[model samples]
Target: MSYDSAKAAFADWGVDTETALSKLAEIPISMHCWQGDDVVGFEAKTGNSGGGIQATGNHPGRARTPDELRADLEFSYSMIPGKHRLNLHACYLDTDQNPDRDEIEYSHFAPWVDWATDQGLGLDFNPTFFAHEKADDNLTLSHPDQGIREFWIEHGKRSRDIAAQMGAALGSPVVNNIWVPDGYKDTPVDRMEPRQRLENSLDTMMATKHDKAQMLDAVESKLFGIGVEACTVGSHEFYMGYATRKGTLLCLDMGHFHPTENVADKLSSVALSVDEILLHVSRPMRWDSDHVILLDDAILQMAQELVSAGLLDRTHIGLDFFDATISRTAAWVIGTRNMQKALLRALLAPWDRLKSAENNLDYTSRLVVTEEIKDLPYATVWAEFCDRMGVPSGQSLISDLHQYQAGVSGRG
Candidate 1:
């Protein structure tokens, strides 16, 4: 059936497919640059993943240079149906002159701004708190050593400055996220000190004033990590209080929480407190593995909650996984496309009926309507969305990826 037929089908359920498609088109997913190289940033001479984040699988054709990474990203954006932004970690900065992370400056990323300008892509930034020598003993900002803490603080300051420049260049506010792996392998004798140090370090970093329109600061929290199994200093509770008191955006990484923890449930609660939020959507099998995102139940719930809470515009969505097990470009397309698909499905939901059923205490009707919407022509509408996007639908997108791999990424 044609997209027009699909539109009529959805309209029967009171869903304006046209409006949904338009809104979905405007929601740009921030694709992470680390995926193109399996989290091994361009500055890492040894390809060390550091900070308990490791990308499994040794897929061939990984981009080795910034130029190659950008080329792969160019091809990735082509396969994807809409405009997107690039999320760059501080470690990925260009290295014409080998400056350590502490000494790095926005000048190193001038080429990136030029490229993003040409591609018409927005930019997001992250401070690399791990995989560096300064991250002594699985601690960075929370380190007891004042010099090491100062080093990371300086890097954070510089990263925010670079993101501000990116926003100025791209005509959009940049989301600058900071997720440090500061914790203890075993139970620490003192937890308050580490948390206090982190708080102080963050104060120093955010003390540097920047235009709010140009750069928005956000801090991410993790329950635990590979090495830091005992406790994570920057726990959800810690960042929650800090974000509320300090007025910074809070980032919720899907993989950072426990397996049973529903990150979706936290959306409404956090939304009431913070002005804006950043979401790092990824799949976690057993831990923070950073697996590529799929159209799983967890993802569906996350999107539904975001839509139901009327936060589609207030929250910034970004992909945060490095699955080197598959074709790098395929990983990008799969994760990004699945993210769009989940959001579209949520948009098509009959929220009025669902909420009315809840208000009337009609549990039976609510459950029925919820299960019934699952069987709608979502795939049909998705294909139509691809058509509206002027990109290939169904398995046809695979062919485009294959052709690019043969002509471009495969060359690496």
Candidate 2:
């Protein structure tokens, strides 16, 4: 049989074609993670480099025009849905330096909609801001550079217009997600200025929308590193407490913590509207490398806790990572697998047992973390069971089950 036919036959016997194809699709995926070249806003910038948008010099990486972007989307869909949840750093666009160029270059949001529709991928917009702007409580914009500041003011209008257009095209609110990288460095530099302007701009933008759009404003808080000393919305608890109070929800990026920090406890401490907590998944580590790790049991346990606490429901997960040396497709496939594994472990957890313990106040203390999922010292049984079910351990979870079935039938 041909490869496609054989693959179909295997799938007919209950193999997961999506998982298998995702593995092979990684080979041709381009490495464009943190380069910030992909976001629609970054397109307005003048110069490009191997890394991403720059101030003056030309970017070396293959510059994709609107047509090229559409083509890329087609290619990606043919292979598999390229990661829909996108995280673009705000500083990459540098609102302070080249606001006009950034806006001009990034006006390709319309084409992005065409591609997303063709591919059947949901757009989770994450415009991560690294600098601060000042807007009056009335939502009037302000900034340090008068020229660029005015440019940003206009850029906001352009962005809203693009979003409205895209929303109409998709028949859904296009401005779906927002995450602010605003916080203090050393001491509070902008103090309340950053927070005030960001909120003001968002409130104004939301008011302009003709239809209702679901907004998940991930107020991420940082510990220390880069120029960030105190993150504006550092932890889930912090975001829940602060952003929810400001009438915005939270987005929790897991990688923003030390090993010792109790992920569940920290999550619990945030007293706010349960809907305020939105989960953004990634292995916990510093900002050094976005290496995706296995979704261990700890994360599963925490997920269970969030579910019990009503903090997470219908919240989409973001596979956030950036490694230039690896194939873009491969990184996504691996990251997706890791994420899936964590989710599976969460699904398979002894929920009944966990819930019962909560009544005794002992459950929270016994909650598992991702670390436990890593050292599955007694995973031989589970692995064997998976093998017996014909689940493809490497690429196809279903193929692994099929192989197990064939082996069992042969033995019988």
User: Worst ten-residue run, lDDT, model 1?
Assistant: 42-51
Local distance difference test, each candidate? 0.89, 0.42
Off by over 4 Å in 1: 44-48, 408-412
Worst 10 residues of 2 by lDDT: 48-57
TM agreement with the true structure for every prediction: 0.97, 0.60
Deviation in Å, model 2, residue 35 alpha carbon: 7.7
lDDT per residue as tens, model 2, 182-261 = 34435654555655565455555445544435323445543434444454423345445556666554555565556566
